[model samples]
Target: MTAHFVQVANAERLAADVMADVMTPPPPVDYLRWAEDNIIFTERESPLPGPYNRDLFFYFDEILRALSPDDPCRIVSVHKSAQLGGTVLANIFCGGSLAMDPGDFLYVHPTENNAQRWSKMKLVPMLKGTPALTKLFPMKARDGSDSVLYKERIDGKGAIQISGANSPASLSQVTMKRQVQDDLSKWEMNNAGDPETQADSRSQAHEFAKILKVSTPLVDPGCRITKSFEDGSQEKLYLPCPQCGHMQTLEWENFLANLDEDKPENSHFVCVDTECGGVIEEHHRPAMFKAAKLLELNGVEVWRSENPKAKRFHRSFHLWSAYSLLQSFERIARAWLNARGDPASEQTFFNDVVGRAYKTLGEAPPWEGLRDRAAKSDHPKGRIPVGFPIVTVGVDCQADRVEFQVVAWGRDYRRAVVDYGVFPGHISTKECWAFLDGLVRQEYANGYGRKIGMDLLAIDGNAWTEDVWGWAKRHLSSKVIMVRGVPSESAPLLARVKKERSRSGKLLSYSKRFYNFATSVLKMGLYRNLVKDDPLSRGHIALPRGLDDEYFRQLTAESRRAKRLKTGFIAYEWVKDPAQANEGLDTHLQAEAAAIKFGVRSMPDSMWDRYEADRERPPAEAQYEIEDLMAPGLPYVPPAPAAAPALPTKKLTKAKVRRGKWMNADG
Candidate 1:
């Protein structure tokens, strides 16, 4: 009886001791370091599964540390290119929040679809694959405790609700201690003007609420994320040159190695230091990463600084592809080389690849800028200039007449308006289209002697859609296409291509292909081309001398005006001046559309060289016989018949021409 009483007392005491120990908080540890030790890369979904490699991601150590609970700063903005270990930062942040400071976390994406995709591709895989995380956030779809859009920690007062920027109500309803907004730049506009006000409203309850904003950045400074990036401390990554040991931010201009043109892949990069221009080979990246450091720029450098004030509490960083271990200098150089001349592509290179906003395309050209640069051509209106290879035709339909132009394209996208005129017939009549066909079939002899014919034709099918559609069916070929304008301001110069259907609802036999080209983007390209200081730039137009002043007036008729969006963002559009006609501008834009569809931009130099070599030689004179000229009444002379060579008696060394058939020949 005495032993049993003692055992029960000891068991109770031991249980009490265990409960006390469970209440004790875990010791402080670096959140990033802890993640590196525990987080598994997940082999089923990721090739790199295991403990995180701190050396590979050493640069992020300071940024992640500042996001830790120990840090005083409550907000952080990571403006960067995609797939540069930004997700790893997100993972470690969530893991730390769950383990130490247990509370709600809201992961926001650009849209509902984006949120769902990230949960499936990133969140779920991350939890199920990592043993450490799997224990904390186990999957249980049936119980409603764990789901794709929401999750509750199995052992803590922690939960995560994933939502999109579009759902502002959801963002405000659920208060979270930490908000992870991935791709913040892509968030859709809200009725309230800014989605940030609604989303940030949720975090008002917590004093130390963490707001993490990450994005690749969009064009407009009015974009929510771009504005945020400017407001925060602008931090940049700098690396010591492996060769010269001079610290510098690696920019696209510093290292230019691929001017050789033919073998672009062999492009190289070097240090920017003029005194020590040293080759920075691929192998030197590891050392560069080791020496990499982040420098926070002053307020003056931030985009659109008002009073040189940067948010003291928020940490913002901007890193380019140059510092990315996965990206190479050669790869970035090649992308720049291809994107240099064209605004859309060049902007893409700046925004997506380098994670920097592109410079504004600039203002419209002065009306006389291109007019002064016009090439003096001796060839007449119907003739193609020397060195011009391919020709494209642009046709515009109107109520009274059809305006058409023949534009010749050469290497470097050099354009020549060889011929243009008004067809004196209404679009509703058959004569207008017939005149178009006649112009298409007409060939012009170029200065190089090459018989130049239109390689591609694009006709605007804006008004009189039915008439244009019917006419396109009869005239459409591999080289001919109909273009309909899509007023989508954000779309590229070429938006979507599809096949046109006849009245019977079946695809047409000829010219079935139709393109929904964005007029706004094309106009932007046109304006940018005209504004080029160098005549050699792509999209530059060389007007022939014969064109009258009225043609010039029509060509420069359109001027760009900024159109304000509902969200207060500025969008520029080409508005026609009421005083001048824009038919000439439309023709040139359509001609460019035709050239783009024909793949002239992608044509190889060797193919262009072959085109350059061919000359338009005149057709040879017809061969004629003397009998054709001689009259049939003329009498033949006997001496002429006797002049025929005598038959050889001996075996001839060489065969002699004989009129007799093989069977009748001498045996």
Candidate 2:
């Protein structure tokens, strides 16, 4: 009951608590034999709750152990679905590494809020609830500090630093041997502008590059995380094939889309070489299946954990299923849109969830046999070859180059990029007009002696449009060339163009059928035909390349606006700035696209007569109706009154009275 006795009793309890927190010995197992055979972690965590499974656990554990001590960093990029225990596995690696080696380890999330949430929801609960795990170290509640340090466990200094992407300064201060990025894509830039460019460059530039990058795919191909995963220079996780026994790493190129209809999908693979036909099928290994199938790739150790039978142990681990479910459909749609700029998937995933509406890529443009046609002008013949109806000249212009497509239409269809000029350094408006005049002279030789129904000659209004417009007005007649207004905001128009791009890439332009020749060429993809071989189709199909960045932006915008109908045609709108949308080029390109839209591809100068004729004819649909009624009250008659009007007719009146014979009697 004395103070001294109370102190002694408190000391005894403290000693007992300390004694309980020690790492216990491993059960009788042949570590030596297991090492020799190299077969380890076999027991399903399902079969024995707490026992070590060498065949399963050792596969990943050995990898962690195999790294060089000085440069001990591994970046594992994982693409997974729900129910894979990759999170727990990641946590296990984090905890185990700190336990085995005394050093700092940081777990970086995309945001501070996420870091706090993970610590509260996963880390704190796991460490506190697991009695067996807690016994390995002294634990304490989190103070204001961002890290939870496990004091001096196994002569290895252990501490876990938790940080969000925003706290780069704090994250940089930590000198850690290992860093784990959990779902880096989710921590994107909330602000405007390019998210990829806004990401923390110092992380990779300093040390995080040497660590691990782990996440699901994102919507943007240009995303920082996606770019990092796609980078070929980095050492990716590769696994030895059970068949050929050769090692291979997973790549997006290896994935076969729509391979599975249910949970636990399989991947189909051939030899990495373009020529080899060797096949490899990747499925759930027994040990891997036993752990939890979060996601699997060749040789990547990305697996999650499952619920333990014991409540304490169950509560101690984070299930991958929970994390996977957190991935919203918005995220998936975003990823789909990112991987390919097609917005058809955006509508399906985000709006209706019906399905991807169009091809992953845009439609194959109508193959305009660039090579052979480039040699000499080729004109498809049917009608008059020389003098025909009015002629409409359709030209398409680009920034550095101007494509003068002279589409002469009648009974005959003649099209040619007659004058191709690649201008330098954004030429002046006078130069542009001069160039246009030159093209006309070179192609038509006296303008072909016909009136040209010119479409819009969109000049660079944003830059040097005034000069170009002035020159154009001075040189060309109002009847010969009319420039249309092109609005600066063309995002909506671009969206429409993107939506109708073919899924199978049929020889077509924006859901419109290409002429039969072009269609036939496209059907026989990437081939050298004996006759009328289409080089553009062949080259485009045979060697797919990323579109130009500016063009890609335009395509993406167009795709977003595209509306797919049950009628098998994609409806879209095209808006180009009349003054400056098509680089510094003239209105020819704009005119051509407009001509195509109007379904007037080729017509001679005489064809301009059609518009005049149309103007003279009465419009087909015009009529109106009116209410029928007579004037109110007796059909509306006016009463007249006598006055001075009789004075003027006095003589006539006297004559009329004499006829009655009364005048003779009065006389």
Query: Which of the numbered candidates is closest to the native, going by highest TM-score?
Result: 1
**What lDDT is reached at residue 295 by model 2?**
26
Clashing pairs in 1: 449-615, 449-616, 450-615, 450-616
Candidate 1 Cα RMSD after full superposition onto the native fold (Å): 16.4
Residue ranges of candidate 2 with Cα displaced over 4 Å: 1-63, 66-84, 129-138, 141-158, 190-210, 232-667
lDDT tens per residue, model 2, 1-667:
6555333458877888777755454233322222323212223323334433444443334333323243223344433332243455555556555544436666777778777888776776555544433655445434433244223343244567777766545455445566667765455433332222223332344442325555543333222344443441222334434344344443333433423323222334454644444554444233233333222423434422222222211111111111222233234334443323113223223211211111222222223332333334232211112322323443333343333333333222222222222332134445555666654443221122222333333222223434444444554332223223332111111111222333586532312211111111111111212122332321111111211222212211211134444433233323333321222123333433334333443334455566435332222342212221343454422211111111000111223222421122123
> What's model 1's overall lDDT?
0.68
Which digits, one per residue and each the tens of the lDDT, describe model 1 over residues 12-53?
778899998898876674777678766767575345556787
Model 2 error, position 419 (Å): 42
Q: What is the C-alpha RMSD of each candidate to the true structure, in Å?
A: 16.4, 26.2
Estimated TM-score for each candidate: 0.70, 0.34
